[model samples]
Target: MHQAIPYRTWIHANTRDSRDLPLAVRGAGVDSASVAKLVSENAVIVIGRRGCCMCHVIKRLLQGLGVNPPVYEVDEHHEAAVAAHLGAATVQFPAVFVGGKLFGGLERVMATHISGELVPILKDAGALWL
Candidate 1:
């Protein structure tokens, strides 16, 4: 199944290596420039406090939709900084970005999924190949 596999599997495979990131790469207020690069670079990202259950929910939903987004599990102290970098007014746990833009949190994600729009959105975001 690895052969001709969609990008979802690849994203999930890489998610396990997050623990290897050095402290500097973890946060320290998550410098705006680096945050910009992160949002611009990935098709989908889940920014939330480390070990947040809501973040896990978002990730699982995406995976169920065939999109395994790489999450940036930030520290609580840096949520505001990350939120500002993403152009949001306030910090929202499990803040999701799709196609390099803020896609809101669990509420928006679940709404989109229940409405049957998530798969197409993931496809358009290039996070889903099938």
Candidate 2:
């Protein structure tokens, strides 16, 4: 018999620690503290563009899972700053965060869901009642 590890610890161990990441991927206007605070307080957060199709898909997926994640639409000027703060390159939209940890983008979320791990993670993060 194997003991199951809590999703938070499992996620922390699986994902790269944001603290060890460089201040900014693009090296400009990155406020690490603000990014950290936003993620920490929100059980789930999706930062994406208002008109991006992929962003819509991500939001829909979360909603289908019974999650009500906050979405922050990135404006042109703040795009770089948000990307850098999240340690993401090239201003990727729809960055996902769960339980105050960076959970990558749509592909990662989909992969986790396909692997049947997303529900446990959502439950652990208090984003799911079931």
Candidate 3:
């Protein structure tokens, strides 16, 4: 026997890894503090796709940093086009933006944090640990 599933759920789950999140390749001039502030305030959107490992890692990293980010699925939202274009990315999975600026992908995010750039950014953004 076969199991049944909801159409919307199926679509969302299946499109989790679809090419729709545009990420900036040249790395935009985004300060980590700006991102931390937005995420901490839950004002910025954390664009992500379901079933994406990189996306998951980004979320975990943000959480580790004590940031509760607002998540959005680019492929599921038409307005994402504006962000994608502004981000200058090719709709890659897991695109993070803060204060209307593209903050690059997981690799960049991790690198910044490891290089001790994330803390200062988060602190300036008023989202870092006291």
lDDT of each: 0.72, 0.67, 0.51
Best by TM-score: 1
lDDT of 2 by residue, 17-109 (tens): 444332112212335675656578678877775456787688788888888676655556777777777766764667888897778888899
Which of the two, 1 or 2, has more TM-score? 1
Candidates sorted on lDDT, descending: 1, 2, 3
TM-score of each: 0.76, 0.67, 0.54
Sort by TM-score, top down from the best: 1, 2, 3
Q: Which runs of model 2 end up more than 4 angstroms from their true locations?
A: 1-35, 87-91
Q: After superposition, how far is residue 7 of candidate 2 from its true place, in Å?
A: 38
Backbone N/Cα/C clashes per model: 0, 0, 5
Q: Give the alpha carbon lDDT tens digit for every residue of 61-93 in model 1.
A: 887877767677777777777788778797577
